[model samples]
Target: MNECTYKNYDELPLMLNVVQVAAVLGISRAGAYELVHSEDFPTLKIGSRIVVPKDKLREWIDANTAQK
Candidate 1:
């Protein structure tokens, strides 16, 4: 992945695929998949594709960070 091509999560499209989520979270692709599979992870399934909504992703981050 090109570091130059990375976008801030806030600047990403409204919906993000797993790879983009991984990039923003700085996690491995497999870790991103695992996160999306969690019951509490914010995700939407369209047919066979799983995507994370940008707003929900931010909400999830906020919620998690607030607990620390």
Candidate 2:
């Protein structure tokens, strides 16, 4: 598990691995796993691999930007 905090979503690549996502979100791989299960985060399952779409992530950020 790793922790990361990416200040700019635009700086993230279009496709990111789970570990990278975890790093960007400042969460551990386990926490990311939980998020995937809840379907609240953006992820795409290709075959047996999980990938996150940067654009979708940006949209989610936009939606949550003003949250308290």
The best candidate by TM-score is 1
Where does candidate 1 stray beyond 4 Å? 1-10, 66-68
Supply candidate 2's per-residue lDDT for 21: 72
For each candidate, what is the lDDT? 0.86, 0.77
CA lDDT, candidate 2, residue 28: 89
What's the distance in Å from true for residue 46, model 2?
0.5
Error of model 2, residue 43, in angstroms: 1.5
Model 1 misses residue 27 by how many Å? 0.2
Candidate achieving the largest lDDT: 1
| Candidate 2 off by > 4 Å | 1-10, 66-68
TM-scores, all models, native as reference? 0.84, 0.72
Candidate 2's error at 50, in angstroms? 0.7
Per-residue accuracy of model 1 over 1-68 as CA lDDT, tens digit each: 31324555557889989998888887888899999999899999999999999999999998888553
Supply the global lDDT for candidate 2.
0.77
